[model samples]
Target: MSTPDIVLTRIDNRLVHGQVGVVWTSAIGANLLLVANDAAAKDELQQELMTATAETAGVGIRFWTLDKTISTIHKASARQHIFLVVKTPADVLTLVKGGVPITEVNVGNMHYSDGKEQISKKVYMDQADKDAINGLIDAGVKVYIKDVPEDKEQVLQKF
Candidate 1:
Protein backbone atom coordinates (compact mmCIF):
# COMPACT_ATOMS: atom_id res chain seq x y z
CA MET A 1 0.00 0.00 0.00
CA SER A 2 1.23 3.46 -0.86
CA THR A 3 0.56 6.27 1.58
CA PRO A 4 -0.04 9.86 0.64
CA ASP A 5 2.70 12.36 1.34
CA ILE A 6 2.06 13.74 4.84
CA VAL A 7 3.42 17.24 4.44
CA LEU A 8 2.60 18.35 7.96
CA THR A 9 1.05 16.80 11.05
CA ARG A 10 -0.14 19.56 13.34
CA ILE A 11 -1.88 19.71 16.70
CA ASP A 12 -4.16 22.70 16.96
CA ASN A 13 -7.06 23.04 19.37
CA ARG A 14 -9.05 25.14 16.91
CA LEU A 15 -8.68 22.49 14.17
CA VAL A 16 -9.28 24.33 10.90
CA HIS A 17 -9.07 28.06 11.44
CA GLY A 18 -7.78 30.88 9.24
CA GLN A 19 -4.12 30.16 9.93
CA VAL A 20 -4.59 26.51 9.12
CA GLY A 21 -7.02 26.79 6.21
CA VAL A 22 -5.17 29.59 4.50
CA VAL A 23 -1.62 29.97 5.73
CA TRP A 24 -0.55 26.42 6.58
CA THR A 25 -2.37 24.93 3.61
CA SER A 26 -0.61 27.21 1.15
CA ALA A 27 2.73 27.05 2.90
CA ILE A 28 2.85 23.27 2.98
CA GLY A 29 1.45 22.86 -0.51
CA ALA A 30 -0.94 20.21 0.69
CA ASN A 31 -3.67 19.14 -1.67
CA LEU A 32 -5.73 17.59 1.12
CA LEU A 33 -6.39 18.40 4.77
CA LEU A 34 -7.01 15.23 6.75
CA VAL A 35 -8.60 15.86 10.14
CA ALA A 36 -8.20 12.87 12.45
CA ASN A 37 -10.45 13.50 15.41
CA ASP A 38 -13.33 11.41 16.74
CA ALA A 39 -15.48 14.39 17.77
CA ALA A 40 -14.98 16.12 14.44
CA ALA A 41 -15.74 13.01 12.42
CA LYS A 42 -19.22 12.78 13.89
CA ASP A 43 -20.07 16.49 14.02
CA GLU A 44 -21.92 17.41 10.84
CA LEU A 45 -21.77 21.13 11.48
CA GLN A 46 -18.05 21.08 12.14
CA GLN A 47 -17.53 18.97 9.03
CA GLU A 48 -19.50 21.42 6.92
CA LEU A 49 -17.60 24.40 8.27
CA MET A 50 -14.19 22.84 7.82
CA THR A 51 -15.08 21.53 4.39
CA ALA A 52 -16.11 25.00 3.32
CA THR A 53 -12.88 26.39 4.72
CA ALA A 54 -10.82 23.82 2.80
CA GLU A 55 -12.74 24.50 -0.40
CA THR A 56 -12.20 28.23 0.01
CA ALA A 57 -8.48 27.49 0.39
CA GLY A 58 -8.58 25.45 -2.83
CA VAL A 59 -7.95 22.12 -1.12
CA GLY A 60 -9.92 18.98 -0.44
CA ILE A 61 -10.68 17.89 3.14
CA ARG A 62 -11.51 14.69 4.96
CA PHE A 63 -12.82 14.28 8.50
CA TRP A 64 -11.98 10.82 9.73
CA THR A 65 -11.92 9.11 13.08
CA LEU A 66 -8.45 8.04 14.22
CA ASP A 67 -9.17 4.43 13.36
CA LYS A 68 -10.45 5.33 9.92
CA THR A 69 -7.46 7.54 9.31
CA ILE A 70 -5.10 4.72 10.24
CA SER A 71 -6.82 2.09 8.12
CA THR A 72 -7.39 4.12 5.01
CA ILE A 73 -4.77 6.84 4.85
CA HIS A 74 -2.58 4.60 2.75
CA LYS A 75 -5.37 4.41 0.19
CA ALA A 76 -4.86 7.99 -0.87
CA SER A 77 -3.13 8.41 -4.19
CA ALA A 78 0.58 9.26 -4.13
CA ARG A 79 -0.23 12.62 -5.69
CA GLN A 80 -2.28 13.60 -2.63
CA HIS A 81 -0.17 15.68 -0.31
CA ILE A 82 -1.93 15.54 3.07
CA PHE A 83 -1.85 17.94 5.98
CA LEU A 84 -3.05 16.00 9.00
CA VAL A 85 -4.50 18.00 11.88
CA VAL A 86 -5.72 16.84 15.25
CA LYS A 87 -6.69 18.55 18.50
CA THR A 88 -4.22 16.98 20.92
CA PRO A 89 -0.93 15.18 21.37
CA ALA A 90 -2.89 12.14 22.54
CA ASP A 91 -4.68 11.93 19.19
CA VAL A 92 -1.33 12.15 17.41
CA LEU A 93 -0.03 9.38 19.63
CA THR A 94 -3.08 7.28 18.78
CA LEU A 95 -2.42 7.73 15.07
CA VAL A 96 1.24 6.86 15.50
CA LYS A 97 0.48 3.80 17.59
CA GLY A 98 -2.10 2.75 15.02
CA GLY A 99 0.68 2.73 12.36
CA VAL A 100 0.23 6.03 10.58
CA PRO A 101 3.70 7.10 9.40
CA ILE A 102 4.19 10.34 11.30
CA THR A 103 7.82 11.23 11.95
CA GLU A 104 7.41 14.89 12.85
CA VAL A 105 4.62 16.83 14.54
CA ASN A 106 4.15 20.60 14.70
CA VAL A 107 2.65 21.77 17.96
CA GLY A 108 0.47 24.72 17.08
CA ASN A 109 -2.17 25.90 19.54
CA MET A 110 -2.83 23.84 22.61
CA HIS A 111 -5.06 26.21 24.57
CA TYR A 112 -4.44 27.05 28.20
CA SER A 113 -6.89 25.24 30.42
CA ASP A 114 -7.08 24.36 34.10
CA GLY A 115 -4.51 21.77 35.18
CA LYS A 116 -2.36 22.48 32.15
CA GLU A 117 1.11 23.99 32.26
CA GLN A 118 2.23 26.51 29.68
CA ILE A 119 4.87 24.94 27.49
CA SER A 120 5.08 27.70 24.90
CA LYS A 121 3.28 30.91 24.01
CA LYS A 122 0.37 29.08 22.39
CA VAL A 123 0.80 25.62 23.96
CA TYR A 124 -0.18 24.13 27.29
CA MET A 125 -0.04 20.59 28.60
CA ASP A 126 -1.11 18.56 31.56
CA GLN A 127 0.43 15.26 32.70
CA ALA A 128 -1.39 13.21 30.07
CA ASP A 129 -0.33 15.53 27.29
CA LYS A 130 3.24 15.39 28.49
CA ASP A 131 3.17 11.63 28.59
CA ALA A 132 1.75 11.40 25.08
CA ILE A 133 4.39 13.78 23.73
CA ASN A 134 7.13 11.84 25.48
CA GLY A 135 5.86 8.65 23.93
CA LEU A 136 6.05 10.22 20.50
CA ILE A 137 9.59 11.38 21.11
CA ASP A 138 10.53 7.94 22.40
CA ALA A 139 9.09 6.47 19.22
CA GLY A 140 11.50 8.60 17.17
CA VAL A 141 9.09 11.36 16.23
CA LYS A 142 10.50 14.90 16.13
CA VAL A 143 7.99 17.03 18.04
CA TYR A 144 8.42 20.80 17.91
CA ILE A 145 6.45 23.88 18.95
CA LYS A 146 5.70 26.45 16.27
CA ASP A 147 2.51 28.39 15.73
CA VAL A 148 3.13 29.54 12.17
CA PRO A 149 5.27 28.58 9.21
CA GLU A 150 7.40 31.69 9.47
CA ASP A 151 8.17 31.20 13.20
CA LYS A 152 11.35 29.56 14.38
CA GLU A 153 10.81 25.93 15.40
CA GLN A 154 11.36 25.23 19.07
CA VAL A 155 12.36 21.65 19.66
CA LEU A 156 10.24 20.34 22.52
CA GLN A 157 12.42 18.43 24.97
CA LYS A 158 12.55 17.89 28.77
CA PHE A 159 9.49 20.03 29.30
Candidate 2:
Protein backbone atom coordinates (compact mmCIF):
# COMPACT_ATOMS: atom_id res chain seq x y z
CA MET A 1 0.00 0.00 0.00
CA SER A 2 1.15 3.54 -0.66
CA THR A 3 0.95 6.46 1.74
CA PRO A 4 -1.70 8.93 0.63
CA ASP A 5 -0.93 12.59 0.70
CA ILE A 6 -3.32 14.11 3.22
CA VAL A 7 -3.55 17.55 1.73
CA LEU A 8 -5.70 19.08 4.43
CA THR A 9 -6.91 18.13 7.88
CA ARG A 10 -9.60 20.27 9.46
CA ILE A 11 -11.27 20.14 12.87
CA ASP A 12 -14.88 21.11 12.45
CA ASN A 13 -17.56 20.07 14.92
CA ARG A 14 -20.01 19.91 12.09
CA LEU A 15 -17.95 17.62 9.89
CA VAL A 16 -19.84 18.26 6.68
CA HIS A 17 -21.40 21.63 5.88
CA GLY A 18 -21.48 24.25 3.15
CA GLN A 19 -18.34 25.94 4.50
CA VAL A 20 -16.45 22.65 4.65
CA GLY A 21 -18.18 20.48 2.11
CA VAL A 22 -18.22 23.19 -0.54
CA VAL A 23 -15.83 26.00 0.33
CA TRP A 24 -12.95 24.06 1.86
CA THR A 25 -13.31 21.10 -0.44
CA SER A 26 -13.26 23.30 -3.52
CA ALA A 27 -10.36 25.33 -2.20
CA ILE A 28 -8.32 22.27 -1.39
CA GLY A 29 -9.38 20.50 -4.58
CA ALA A 30 -9.79 17.32 -2.62
CA ASN A 31 -10.97 14.16 -4.35
CA LEU A 32 -11.68 12.41 -1.04
CA LEU A 33 -13.16 13.71 2.21
CA LEU A 34 -12.58 11.44 5.18
CA VAL A 35 -14.60 12.07 8.33
CA ALA A 36 -12.69 10.38 11.14
CA ASN A 37 -15.03 10.30 14.12
CA ASP A 38 -15.84 7.32 16.30
CA ALA A 39 -19.44 8.33 16.88
CA ALA A 40 -20.17 9.06 13.22
CA ALA A 41 -18.55 5.83 12.14
CA LYS A 42 -20.85 3.69 14.30
CA ASP A 43 -24.04 5.69 13.65
CA GLU A 44 -25.66 4.90 10.36
CA LEU A 45 -27.69 8.10 10.48
CA GLN A 46 -24.55 10.21 10.91
CA GLN A 47 -22.86 8.36 8.07
CA GLU A 48 -25.89 8.97 5.87
CA LEU A 49 -25.90 12.65 6.77
CA MET A 50 -22.21 13.07 5.93
CA THR A 51 -22.61 11.02 2.77
CA ALA A 52 -25.49 13.18 1.63
CA THR A 53 -23.64 16.39 2.36
CA ALA A 54 -20.45 15.23 0.60
CA GLU A 55 -22.50 14.05 -2.35
CA THR A 56 -23.90 17.55 -2.73
CA ALA A 57 -20.34 18.88 -2.81
CA GLY A 58 -19.48 16.29 -5.48
CA VAL A 59 -16.80 14.65 -3.32
CA GLY A 60 -16.31 11.18 -1.93
CA ILE A 61 -16.61 10.80 1.87
CA ARG A 62 -15.96 8.03 4.34
CA PHE A 63 -16.75 8.03 8.06
CA TRP A 64 -14.21 5.90 9.85
CA THR A 65 -13.41 5.18 13.49
CA LEU A 66 -9.98 5.91 14.96
CA ASP A 67 -8.80 2.34 14.63
CA LYS A 68 -10.21 2.01 11.18
CA THR A 69 -8.54 5.25 10.18
CA ILE A 70 -5.16 4.02 11.43
CA SER A 71 -5.51 0.73 9.62
CA THR A 72 -6.46 2.43 6.39
CA ILE A 73 -4.02 5.34 6.67
CA HIS A 74 -1.71 4.00 3.99
CA LYS A 75 -4.55 3.43 1.55
CA ALA A 76 -6.00 6.88 2.20
CA SER A 77 -2.55 8.45 1.82
CA ALA A 78 -2.18 6.76 -1.55
CA ARG A 79 -4.85 9.05 -2.96
CA GLN A 80 -3.81 12.21 -4.76
CA HIS A 81 -5.85 14.66 -2.72
CA ILE A 82 -7.49 13.98 0.64
CA PHE A 83 -9.27 16.39 2.96
CA LEU A 84 -9.75 14.91 6.41
CA VAL A 85 -12.31 16.21 8.89
CA VAL A 86 -12.49 15.31 12.55
CA LYS A 87 -14.74 16.66 15.30
CA THR A 88 -12.03 17.44 17.87
CA PRO A 89 -8.35 18.08 18.48
CA ALA A 90 -8.11 14.79 20.32
CA ASP A 91 -8.93 13.03 17.10
CA VAL A 92 -6.16 14.91 15.33
CA LEU A 93 -3.67 13.87 17.99
CA THR A 94 -4.74 10.27 17.59
CA LEU A 95 -4.29 10.43 13.82
CA VAL A 96 -0.80 11.88 14.16
CA LYS A 97 0.22 9.32 16.77
CA GLY A 98 -1.17 6.61 14.56
CA GLY A 99 1.35 7.63 11.88
CA VAL A 100 -0.87 9.85 9.70
CA PRO A 101 1.91 12.50 9.26
CA ILE A 102 -0.35 15.48 9.91
CA THR A 103 1.92 18.52 10.11
CA GLU A 104 -0.79 21.18 10.28
CA VAL A 105 -4.48 21.40 11.18
CA ASN A 106 -7.22 23.93 10.50
CA VAL A 107 -9.37 24.47 13.57
CA GLY A 108 -12.62 25.43 11.89
CA ASN A 109 -15.71 25.44 14.11
CA MET A 110 -15.84 23.76 17.46
CA HIS A 111 -19.14 25.50 18.34
CA TYR A 112 -20.33 26.73 21.75
CA SER A 113 -20.55 23.76 24.01
CA ASP A 114 -21.29 23.56 27.76
CA GLY A 115 -17.79 24.05 29.20
CA LYS A 116 -16.02 25.39 26.15
CA GLU A 117 -14.74 28.95 26.23
CA GLN A 118 -15.10 31.05 23.12
CA ILE A 119 -11.62 31.58 21.71
CA SER A 120 -12.80 33.09 18.44
CA LYS A 121 -16.06 33.87 16.66
CA LYS A 122 -16.37 30.33 15.35
CA VAL A 123 -14.18 28.43 17.80
CA TYR A 124 -14.68 27.21 21.38
CA MET A 125 -12.44 25.04 23.52
CA ASP A 126 -12.49 23.55 26.98
CA GLN A 127 -9.45 22.50 29.02
CA ALA A 128 -9.20 19.06 27.49
CA ASP A 129 -9.67 20.50 24.04
CA LYS A 130 -6.96 23.05 24.73
CA ASP A 131 -4.63 20.37 26.01
CA ALA A 132 -5.19 18.23 22.95
CA ILE A 133 -4.59 21.15 20.61
CA ASN A 134 -1.47 22.13 22.55
CA GLY A 135 -0.26 18.58 22.35
CA LEU A 136 -0.47 18.77 18.58
CA ILE A 137 1.47 22.02 18.61
CA ASP A 138 4.09 20.51 20.88
CA ALA A 139 4.31 17.60 18.48
CA GLY A 140 5.13 20.14 15.70
CA VAL A 141 1.73 20.40 14.08
CA LYS A 142 0.96 23.98 13.06
CA VAL A 143 -2.58 24.60 14.26
CA TYR A 144 -4.55 27.30 12.47
CA ILE A 145 -7.91 28.64 13.57
CA LYS A 146 -9.95 29.70 10.58
CA ASP A 147 -13.64 29.37 9.93
CA VAL A 148 -13.62 29.45 6.16
CA PRO A 149 -11.24 29.28 3.25
CA GLU A 150 -11.26 33.06 2.84
CA ASP A 151 -10.48 33.88 6.47
CA LYS A 152 -7.00 34.61 7.78
CA GLU A 153 -5.47 31.74 9.70
CA GLN A 154 -4.98 32.39 13.42
CA VAL A 155 -2.77 30.40 15.73
CA LEU A 156 -4.66 29.12 18.75
CA GLN A 157 -2.83 30.40 21.89
CA LYS A 158 -5.43 30.04 24.59
CA PHE A 159 -3.69 27.15 26.23
Candidate 3:
Protein backbone atom coordinates (compact mmCIF):
# COMPACT_ATOMS: atom_id res chain seq x y z
CA MET A 1 0.00 0.00 0.00
CA SER A 2 1.24 3.53 -0.76
CA THR A 3 1.89 5.63 2.32
CA PRO A 4 -0.26 8.63 3.07
CA ASP A 5 0.56 12.27 2.26
CA ILE A 6 1.84 14.75 4.85
CA VAL A 7 0.43 13.75 8.21
CA LEU A 8 1.75 16.71 10.18
CA THR A 9 3.01 20.14 9.20
CA ARG A 10 4.60 21.98 12.09
CA ILE A 11 5.81 25.56 12.52
CA ASP A 12 8.87 25.37 14.64
CA ASN A 13 11.98 27.46 13.94
CA ARG A 14 14.25 24.81 15.39
CA LEU A 15 13.16 22.30 12.77
CA VAL A 16 15.36 19.27 13.43
CA HIS A 17 16.07 20.03 17.07
CA GLY A 18 15.59 18.05 20.28
CA GLN A 19 11.79 17.89 20.05
CA VAL A 20 11.81 16.58 16.47
CA GLY A 21 14.43 13.88 17.13
CA VAL A 22 12.81 12.59 20.28
CA VAL A 23 9.20 13.50 20.90
CA TRP A 24 7.34 14.40 17.69
CA THR A 25 8.95 11.64 15.65
CA SER A 26 7.81 8.80 17.91
CA ALA A 27 4.60 10.45 19.05
CA ILE A 28 3.39 10.54 15.45
CA GLY A 29 4.94 7.26 14.35
CA ALA A 30 6.38 9.00 11.31
CA ASN A 31 9.52 7.93 9.42
CA LEU A 32 10.18 10.53 6.72
CA LEU A 33 10.98 14.15 7.61
CA LEU A 34 10.78 17.12 5.25
CA VAL A 35 11.86 20.67 6.16
CA ALA A 36 11.12 23.58 3.81
CA ASN A 37 12.89 26.90 4.04
CA ASP A 38 14.57 29.30 1.63
CA ALA A 39 18.00 29.61 3.19
CA ALA A 40 18.37 25.89 3.71
CA ALA A 41 17.30 25.23 0.09
CA LYS A 42 19.17 27.96 -1.81
CA ASP A 43 22.41 27.70 0.16
CA GLU A 44 23.10 24.22 -1.43
CA LEU A 45 26.04 23.91 0.97
CA GLN A 46 23.53 23.85 3.78
CA GLN A 47 21.68 21.02 2.07
CA GLU A 48 21.49 17.96 4.32
CA LEU A 49 22.16 20.32 7.25
CA MET A 50 18.89 19.23 8.78
CA THR A 51 19.62 15.60 7.93
CA ALA A 52 22.82 15.50 10.01
CA THR A 53 20.88 17.11 12.79
CA ALA A 54 17.73 14.99 12.34
CA GLU A 55 19.54 11.64 11.98
CA THR A 56 20.13 11.26 15.69
CA ALA A 57 18.17 7.98 16.13
CA GLY A 58 18.00 6.87 12.47
CA VAL A 59 15.64 8.96 10.36
CA GLY A 60 15.36 10.10 6.70
CA ILE A 61 15.23 13.79 5.76
CA ARG A 62 14.34 15.93 2.72
CA PHE A 63 14.72 19.74 2.77
CA TRP A 64 12.75 21.87 0.34
CA THR A 65 12.02 25.52 -0.32
CA LEU A 66 8.72 27.45 -0.41
CA ASP A 67 8.42 27.18 -4.18
CA LYS A 68 9.45 23.56 -4.29
CA THR A 69 7.19 22.61 -1.43
CA ILE A 70 4.21 24.24 -3.09
CA SER A 71 4.82 22.30 -6.24
CA THR A 72 5.34 18.97 -4.52
CA ILE A 73 2.15 19.18 -2.50
CA HIS A 74 0.10 20.03 -5.57
CA LYS A 75 1.33 16.99 -7.47
CA ALA A 76 0.36 13.97 -5.41
CA SER A 77 2.85 11.18 -4.87
CA ALA A 78 3.19 8.01 -2.82
CA ARG A 79 5.54 9.22 -0.11
CA GLN A 80 6.78 7.51 2.99
CA HIS A 81 5.18 8.41 6.31
CA ILE A 82 6.32 12.05 6.12
CA PHE A 83 5.92 14.82 8.63
CA LEU A 84 6.49 18.12 6.86
CA VAL A 85 7.89 20.99 8.96
CA VAL A 86 8.53 24.67 8.45
CA LYS A 87 10.53 27.17 10.45
CA THR A 88 8.06 30.00 11.05
CA PRO A 89 4.35 30.66 11.41
CA ALA A 90 4.73 33.21 8.64
CA ASP A 91 5.93 30.46 6.36
CA VAL A 92 2.90 28.39 7.25
CA LEU A 93 0.74 31.39 6.58
CA THR A 94 2.40 31.88 3.23
CA LEU A 95 1.69 28.27 2.36
CA VAL A 96 -1.97 28.72 3.18
CA LYS A 97 -2.07 31.91 1.10
CA GLY A 98 -0.58 29.94 -1.75
CA GLY A 99 -3.40 27.34 -1.37
CA VAL A 100 -1.32 24.50 -0.01
CA PRO A 101 -3.01 21.35 1.34
CA ILE A 102 -1.81 21.67 4.91
CA THR A 103 -4.45 21.03 7.54
CA GLU A 104 -2.74 20.44 10.87
CA VAL A 105 -0.24 23.04 12.10
CA ASN A 106 1.77 22.58 15.28
CA VAL A 107 3.70 25.38 16.98
CA GLY A 108 6.62 23.80 18.77
CA ASN A 109 9.15 26.50 19.66
CA MET A 110 9.29 30.01 18.31
CA HIS A 111 12.21 31.59 20.14
CA TYR A 112 12.18 35.15 21.37
CA SER A 113 13.77 37.61 18.99
CA ASP A 114 14.12 41.38 19.34
CA GLY A 115 10.53 42.32 18.52
CA LYS A 116 8.85 39.05 19.38
CA GLU A 117 7.08 39.05 22.71
CA GLN A 118 6.52 35.90 24.74
CA ILE A 119 2.92 34.82 24.18
CA SER A 120 3.06 31.72 26.31
CA LYS A 121 5.42 29.58 28.31
CA LYS A 122 6.78 27.86 25.20
CA VAL A 123 5.74 30.38 22.53
CA TYR A 124 6.99 33.86 21.61
CA MET A 125 4.56 35.13 18.97
CA ASP A 126 4.33 38.79 17.94
CA GLN A 127 1.18 40.68 16.85
CA ALA A 128 1.81 40.33 13.14
CA ASP A 129 2.71 36.73 13.76
CA LYS A 130 -0.44 36.28 15.79
CA ASP A 131 -2.47 37.78 12.95
CA ALA A 132 -0.98 35.36 10.47
CA ILE A 133 -1.67 32.40 12.74
CA ASN A 134 -5.23 33.57 13.31
CA GLY A 135 -5.72 33.97 9.60
CA LEU A 136 -4.69 30.38 9.02
CA ILE A 137 -6.96 29.13 11.78
CA ASP A 138 -9.79 31.27 10.52
CA ALA A 139 -9.21 29.73 7.14
CA GLY A 140 -9.84 26.32 8.75
CA VAL A 141 -6.39 25.12 9.74
CA LYS A 142 -6.11 23.26 13.04
CA VAL A 143 -3.22 24.94 14.88
CA TYR A 144 -1.85 23.49 18.10
CA ILE A 145 1.04 24.49 20.36
CA LYS A 146 2.86 21.75 22.19
CA ASP A 147 6.50 22.02 23.19
CA VAL A 148 7.31 18.40 23.94
CA PRO A 149 5.62 15.02 23.63
CA GLU A 150 4.81 14.81 27.31
CA ASP A 151 3.40 18.32 27.38
CA LYS A 152 -0.30 18.93 26.82
CA GLU A 153 -1.26 20.02 23.33
CA GLN A 154 -2.68 23.53 23.59
CA VAL A 155 -4.67 24.80 20.66
CA LEU A 156 -3.33 28.03 19.23
CA GLN A 157 -6.75 29.57 19.84
CA LYS A 158 -5.98 29.43 23.58
CA PHE A 159 -3.22 31.96 22.93
Relative to the true structure, candidate 1 reaches a TM of 0.98
Per-candidate TM equals: 0.98, 0.94, 0.86
> Which structure is stronger by TM-score: 1 or 2?
1
Lowest-sum lDDT 10-residue window in model 2: 71-80
lDDT of 2 by residue, 14-121 (tens): 888878888899898998888899998899987887787789889988888988988887875454588999999999999998988788999998999799999989
Give the 10-residue window scoring lowest on summed lDDT in candidate 1: 150-159
Given candidate 3, what's the lDDT at residue 99? Answer: 72
Alpha carbon deviation, residue 139, candidate 2 (Å)? 0.7
Q: Comparing 1 and 3 by TM-score, which wins? A: 1
- Give the winner by lDDT: 2 or 3: 2
Angstrom error at residue 1, model 2: 4.7
Candidate rank order under lDDT? 1, 2, 3
Clashing pairs in 3: none
Local error of candidate 1 at 145, Å? 0.7
